[model samples]
Target: MIGMFATSKAGHDKDTVYIIVQEDTEYVYLADGKYKDTEHPKKKNKKHIQIIKKESDDILKEKLIKKQPIYNEEIRKAIGGIVCQKQM
Candidate 1:
């Protein structure tokens, strides 16, 4: 699958980047190297943003498999809230 990586420039001045796995539009957040969950206003919940300090490509691949779905759901819920806000 194609994966696109991008960074968020909103808060903490933290180096937050996310990979979008093309097959299912899954998102995996990486910060530092290992996997960690941090809170950000943009995230639907605290776990939506994860910190990965120095993970290898192989490790990312394995973690991505499980993290993708959870991230995707958080994104969906965040977007839904935005749409609902606009409607009202």
Candidate 2:
């Protein structure tokens, strides 16, 4: 789902967190806002990622669903919040 957070379950990026920017039947495009920014998202197998949040932050979820412009800083901030929560 758009704007959902996920962690890589397989591959070299295993355990790496990312935001789901786009998805199809087979693959999902992900971004960390660092190595994988919105403009150049990494495409990975849908089954290879573990979903973190399906009901995500309202702002980011709305923006992604509406196809509005979003910046890397925003993505990084959003993801940081989630990761922090998980660590706590």
Candidate 3:
């Protein structure tokens, strides 16, 4: 489960932004503001979800790559600090 944050200029409402939730290695797009409980049918785990603003595939990929290390570190720390943890 990972949460991705992005900014999009093509939004209809200035106060609203799209959110993409990547759960179980699947990406789900949520474009109904930020408080709505959008349905993601393509998700596999249903539990692992991500939230991000809607954007082009290239932009999304760029953001994901930029934040991948950060997200990975967070996940490692969350999972008993085993994946990237250093032995002491």
Candidate 4:
């Protein structure tokens, strides 16, 4: 379930959280796009992404359905929160 808010654990994107825009059996199209306000999604191997949690998806999906923008900061906060929770 490498969807929105998944973080990169390996490869060129290590340590960056990304929003997964599309996926397949081997790879996912990630939008680090919010970083520059352009739709530059990087496609990476599925195994490279770390799933911290699915806690953000439902909320984000609701916002998406309402046509609200999901900023990079929100994704960063979600990942940061989840990582903190796991450390506890």
Candidate 5:
């Protein structure tokens, strides 16, 4: 589920939105591009996050799917857009 947005449901980061950078059987690596960048994603249990099914930035999606090198700024901006849209 790379590139998908998920909100932490538990732990200290509860309510924080993160991008799914990678996933495994029991866990998903998340990044916000601010504190948790691609280079250092936060590992969390799949059950602890609520995934956002709605599609977000296409360019970010493409980059994540292609295993491309992405910058933190791009991720931040993309997430900012999503949050803004949700509030409107």
Candidate 6:
């Protein structure tokens, strides 16, 4: 609810890292490598993806502290950071 990082728990993007750009009652908007940016986020069922709220908070804070716009590459970086942390 407060983070941007997530992984596709199901569907075509399964196990793929994504940044949650938007969310609604039944769906959540996601972005990744193949996905362009938050401007064109992918809408998927909430149940279809796993949320990674903890790791993304740092990146989110960095973005806010730097006052940068939410861009596609930033999303990838945020997701990538989480993935890298998980692997270590």
Question: For residues 23-61, could you state the per-residue lDDT of candidate 4 as single tens digits?
Answer: 679987776544532155687788888765554657765
Clashes per prediction?
9, 0, 5, 0, 0, 0
Q: Please, what is the TM-score per model?
A: 0.25, 0.94, 0.25, 0.57, 0.92, 0.75
lDDT per model, in order?
0.37, 0.90, 0.33, 0.64, 0.89, 0.69
The runs of at least 3 residues in candidate 4 whose Cα sits more than 4 Å from the true structure, single-residue gaps closed, are 36-38, 57-59, 62-88
Estimate, for each residue in 4-65, the C-alpha lDDT of model 2 and write its tens digit: 99999999999999999888889999999999999999999988999985446889989988
Model 5, range 61-82, lDDT digits (tens) per residue?
8988888999999889878877
Scored against the true structure, residue 26 in model 4 reaches a CA lDDT of 95
Model 6 CA deviation exceeding 4 Å by range: 53-55, 58-68
Model 4 global lDDT (CA atoms, 0 to 1): 0.64
- Could you give candidate 3's per-residue lDDT for residues 17-49 as a string of tens digits? 333434334434432222333332122222333
Order of all candidates by TM-score, from best down to worst? 2, 5, 6, 4, 3, 1
What RMSD value applies to candidate 4?
3.6
- Model 4 pairs whose backbones collide: none
C-alpha RMSD values across all candidates: 14.0, 1.1, 14.0, 3.6, 1.1, 3.3
Predicted structure with the largest TM-score when compared to the true one: 2
Model 6 weakest lDDT span, ten residues long: 59-68
Best-matching candidate per lDDT: 2
The candidates, ranked best first by lDDT, are: 2, 5, 6, 4, 1, 3
Winner on lDDT between 2 and 5 is 2
